[model samples]
Target: MLGSLFQKFKDGLRKNTPTFQKFFGKVGGLFAAKLDAATIDELEEALFAADFGVETTEEILGEIRAAYRNNKDLRGQDAAKIGATVLSRVLEGAEGQFSPNPEHHPEVIALIGVNGAGKTTTAAKLAWRLQQEGQKVILGACDTFRAAANAQINTWAERLNVEIVSSQHGADSAAVAYDTLQAAKSRGYNVAILDTAGRLHTKGHLLEELKKLGRVVQKLDTSAPHHRWLVVDGSLGSNSIEQARVFHESFGLTGLVITKLDGTSRGGALVGIYRSLKLPVYFVGLGEKPEDLQPFSTTAYVEALFG
Candidate 1:
């Protein structure tokens, strides 16, 4: 199972693997030749370039340097193993877990994030995945702020053969959320994935709107929205760490869904984000297919990232 998952990550990251490997300070999945001073310097530069952040980058470099000093015969692959081990340790307990509570007829998952973070698409994909897992699912289109939000979600619902609840543009998003949960409960749906409007983490008013939506959701079932996930743009590098921090502070994120990773070389940004937020990464967008949004697996991730 882990092997297949690793293959999926490799497939997802194949396009950027060249640059991705460099970001790890590796010369082709291994060091250029030997574990020497020049190689160590290159690794540090690569780690920084990949946005590993100072703490993680320093830890990885320190481990490799220590290994190199103790054993002069340490090889490039050996160093890569040490680095991957450090990364896996830092991201321990990052794999998110979720199972709908039967008492809560329709477990709610509110997808939160700023604009262009792939919230809407993730909502549809998540709904589809849950439905495939035999959980009756409904997508709540609460993103009434973006003009194209309705059209986009509606298209996904139709294409994926799933149900959706939406409102007119500029309408009260909270009201729409209420209606969606109401539909889910009445229709016997087990999961309600709400794709809320994107809010700039810096804007208090926008955050207030999200809080209102959360409050409204709880009125139906105090635990209706069981998962509050932040959908982050993985390509944003260390800036994404700040985004996660701010959203986490205001919205109280339960997990994360990193998207657009297939397009970026700075894949180390994910490690930094996790190190800073410590939030479980529930899902990661690997491709455009519905199944491409694979569940986060630390083992698979470290293997793929370093390889």
Candidate 2:
């Protein structure tokens, strides 16, 4: 299952292949000849172009430098192997698998991100995926502020055949969230995915509204909102890292769902975001279909990049 999923992910990442090929191709040349300062500089430039972020790129470079120092005979493929290992090490810690704890009935997952990050669609896709796994799920259309946000979620609810709780436009979003959880408990749904209003992390008022929504959920169950996920646009590259940082600081985001990986060459930003934030990436959006949102696999992701 994971192999198939990885292939889909690799297919979505075709745009990035040439970049990785060129990067590894240069490194291969360096190793074929003699590892020198010029070779290291060239590798650094490639990583920067790949949008690996400064800190992560430097760490990768440091790892290669140390490996070369330790083993003077290290070849290009060896360097690539070391790079993959270093990348994997950075993404370790957070569990990629997401299953609701039966004990925590109606596991609440709050999806948060800026406008146009694909939160509503991702909520629908997640509901579809969880339902495929035989878990009863409900969606909370808490994004009342966005015009037609409730309508969009309602449409998805009907198509997915899942229960959804929503209110009229301009309603208090916190109230919608509260009622959604209430309905989830009453209906015995295993998962309650709340679709919060998309807001810029820079907006203080909007951030406060998000905090209010969390508080409302906590009112029912303190440990509720079991997962706080940030749906980010992978195409945003390094900007996505800043967005993640702000959201993490504001809400203590538990995981990430990076969308639009299929459309951009900035997929390397995944490594930088995961490395800097140390948050598990639960799923990656490769395409528009429901199944395109595949579970994130470290091995698959690294191989897709270096291959």
User: For model 1, how does the per-residue alpha-carbon lDDT over 1-307 read when each residue is reduced to its tens digit?
Assistant: 5556446545545455454454443445445556678767877876777677899989988999999889887776777788789998999889987778887778889999888899998998888888899999999999998769999999999999999999899899999999999998899998999998886345787789899999998898887578899999887877888768888998898999988766566677888888888899998887677877878878878877675
Residue pairs in candidate 2 whose N, alpha carbon or C atoms collide under 3 angstroms: none
TM-score of 1: 0.92
Taking all chains together, each candidate's TM-score versus the true structure is: 0.92, 0.88
Clash count, one per candidate? 0, 0
* Regions more than 4 Å wrong, model 2: 8-17, 25-40, 66-75, 200-202
- How would you encode candidate 2's per-residue C-alpha lDDT over 182-220 as one tens digit per residue? 988998998999998886345787789999999999999
Q: Candidate 2, TM-score vs. the true structure?
A: 0.88
Any idea what lDDT model 2 has? 0.82
lDDT of each: 0.82, 0.82
**Residue pairs with clashing backbones, model 1:** none
